[model samples]
Target chain A: MKYVLSFNLNGLPVDTLVKATDTLLDVLREKLNVVSPKRGCDNGDCGACTVLVNGEPVRACLTIGLTVAGKNVQTVEGLQQDGKLHPLQRAFHEHYAAQCGFCTPGMLIAAKALLDKNPKPTREQIVEGISGNLCRCGTYVEVVEAIQAVAAGKYKE
Target chain B: MAEYVGQPVLRYDGIGHVTARTRYVDDIQLPGMLYIKVLTSPVHKGIIRHLDTSAAERMPGVAGVITAKDVPGKNAYGLIPDQPVFTPEHIRYKGERIAAVAAVDEDTAMEALEKIKLDIEEQEPVFDPFKAMEPGAPLVRPEGNVWEFNSGKTRKIRFGDVEKGFAEADVIVEGTYTTATNDHAPMEPQVSVAYIDETDRLAIYTVSQDLYFHLGMLTAIFNLPMNKIRYIGGTVGGGFGSKNDIHCDHVAGLMALKIRKPVKYRHTRREETAYTTKRGPWTFYFKDGVKKDGRIIARYVKTVHDTGGYAGMGPYVVDKNSILVAGPYAIPNVWVDGICVFTNKPPCSSMRGFGIINGTAADQLQTARVAEAIGKDPWEVHFINAWREGDLGATQFKVEAAGLIEAMKRAAELAGIELPAHLKAMSSRGR
Candidate 1:
């Protein structure tokens, strides 16, 4: 049995049919055609399917589709506004933080969630913020640097 | 010189990555595409007594079911062509593919897989390489468990007379080193999307590190000419030598041909960790003879690599490892014997640095032991025996453009270690 799921996605209203057992990741990728949140593990062990639900970081693979019925969900696609890249995106691109780009979407979303709460995070805080994400290419140092650059106001809008 | 030399240019695909526009293999979705799930062997070693897929084919939402007989051209495909696409009767390792089902969704396909009937008689399995090499060991294949090199069972490297060099040595150091198996565990799991294009050619979107290599193997598996298939790749989400083999492309291509629709086959994270090829375990036994003057006179290394189930790239990795197991030192007499043995586990293959990293690790430990036995600084021992421009390697390969001395000096400077004036004046151009 499928249910009509309505949610605010990337500042746009999205209505799609999803099963009661469908995960937010499945609905976003298969139904709504939002391919940013990757299906890496599907077990929440990997943070590749991370997204912001109600402005908080959560693993979309673990979140049920029906649970976020009226919540505002944000993906990497939502990081851009008015044809401009977000500061995190700009910093990641400029600092070469993404190698295979498999973990970039999750890392970016997690960083966004971190900086939104703490505008000027220390190095240790930045490490703690993106600890959920894992980069197979071992780009954690560069990712921290990119997040620090964003927090230091190097990539202002 | 190019104008961009030494320039800090951004990655070409950087923008697409950050903006979530890069399309990985899993991201490519076509209409009317069916999901694929495979039936694997549950036992480590077994002989299939019975296998029936009729019940699975009759399941609801099941589009098609393919077994070993459905493989048109060939059932065997690998770097050495020893592995089977679908195990026909004999199962060598756990998670070996027996059949696959294509359905409307992954759940339906998984359910269809449960409908398939399979009967197997489990056999005694060998997990240790040393035990597998014994005379009475259960064979992993029809052939023996040991890989046969062109010369013999071992990859032999003999440069000079080791007995004569060891006779003149003052101290002998021996050590045994072992390294565990490692998984690449790339962020994105193994995935493939296969469909017959409008031109009647089989097209596949893959995350393969070696496209042409897998394309050649896929043609043999599908029994089609090279021009009959279109292999699209180059958007890999971190391979790290794990994507060199044909993981899903062959199975997905076979199912697509059977069902006449686009099929997507992907390994779950559990599947990726449990069954995919890995960096095989290595055990190295090293014995070195060094003089009190910090010069290594003789070195002998015997290494055994556990290449589980099939000869994916084990022989090649062992050969590469044997040639470099003596390290970059300028030893006069070096003898290495590299053995590749098969066990009842997942087949081990390529990883980062092939097999040299394991060999280097063992050799460095042996070098440190040599230093401690002779009451000399490890750095002094390393600098005194470092390879020079005209030095001969273990396989008699001429050393060219050697820069070990300069590299060590720079490494020491960065590491904040002060070198003595005499040691700092050493150069790689000469001794």
Candidate 2:
């Protein structure tokens, strides 16, 4: 049995058919054609499928599709606005924080969530903010620096 | 050359990564594509008594079920061509592939896998390299548990006479070091999307690190010419030597050819961690003969690599390890014996530094022990024995552009360690 899943995605209302057992990641990638949130680990162990649901970071792989009905879902695809990259995106690129880019989408989303809540995050806070994400390339130092650059207003739009 | 050498240039795919526009193998979706799930061996070592996929083929939403019999050209494929695409009769490892099922979705494919019937006669499995090397051990392969190099059973490196060097030594230090297996665990798991293109050529998007090497292997497995297949790669999400082997491409390509549709095969995290080729465990025994003046006169190293199930890259890794197991030091007499043994775990292959890192770990520890035995500073010992530009390596290769002394000086400065004036004045020109 499939249900019509309607949610606000990247500031636009989108509707798609999904099953009860389908995860938000499945619906986004398979049904809605949103391929930003990767399917690294279907479990909650890896944060590669991270997205913002109702202004909070959550693992889309663990979240059931039906639970996010009528909610605002933001992915890395949503980080761009009016043909301009987000501050986090710009900082990540300028700082060379992404390698292989597998963990970049989830890391960017987690960083966006962190900066939205705390505009002026300390180094420790930045580390804790993106702790859920894992970069197998061992780019955590550069990622933290990128987040710090954004928080320090280096990439203010 | 200097313009871009020291600059902080951004990656070419940086924008795509940040903007979520990068397409990985898993992100690719084609019309009427099916998902793949494989049936693996349950026991570590076993002989397949029975295997039936008819029930799985009859399952609802199951598009196709493929077994060892479905392989058209050849079932064996690897660097050494020892591993089978699908285990036909004998199963050497626990997670060896037996069959695969393609269906409408992952759930359906997984459910269809449960329908397949399989029976195996279990056998006693050996996990330790030492135990496996013992006489009358359960054989992992028909030949034996040890990989035979061109010379003999071990990768041998003999330099100056070790007996005379050890005879002149004032102290002898011995230590044993062991390193556990490691998984690459790339952020993106092993995945492949295979489909027959409109040009009638088999197309596959893989996460392979060595695309051409795998392409050659895939051609042999698929029984097709080189131009008959289109191997698309690059944009890999962190390989770290893990993607050097054909993990999912051959299986997905086989299923696509059998089903005549686009098939996507992706390993779950558990599968990637448990079954994929690993760094292979290493056990090293080091014996160093040192003088009271902190000079390492003689070094003897015997290393055993536990290459599980198959000879993926174990022989090459042992050869590379044996050549440099004596470390960067200018030891006069060095003898290294690197042995590659087989166990009943997942086949171990390549990792970050191949096998040099493992050898270096043991060598560094032995160096520290040599320093302690002679009552000398480790740094002084290192500087005294550092390789010069014209020094002969263990394999008699002339060292060129040696920079160990300069590198150590810079490292000490960065690490906030002050070197004595005499030690600081040492140069690699004459060692």
The 10-residue segment with the lowest total lDDT in model 2 chain B:
B72-81
lDDT of 1 by residue, B330-422 (tens): 999999999999999999999998899999999889899999999988899999999999899989889999999999999999999999998
Tell me the tens digit of each residue's lDDT in model 2 across A45-148: 87999999999999999999999999999998888889999999999998899988999999999999999999999999999999999888989999999999
lDDT of 1 by residue, A70-149 (tens): 89999999889998999999999999999999999999999999999999999999999999998999999999999999
Q: Which stretches of candidate 1 lie over 4 Å from their true place?
A: none
Give the C-alpha lDDT of model 2.
Answer: 0.93
lDDT of 2 by residue, B1-431 (tens): 79899887788989998998989988999999999999998899999999989999999899999888988888887788889999999889989999999999989999999998898899999999999999999999989999999979999999998889899999999999999999999999999999999998999999999999999999989999999999999979889998999899999999999888999999999999989999999999999888898899999999999999999988888988999889998999999999999999999898988899999998888898889888998998999999999999989999999999999999999999999999999998885
The TM-score of predicted model 1 comes to: 0.99
Interface RMSD of each: 0.6, 0.7
Candidate 1, position B3, lDDT: 78
Docking class of 2: high
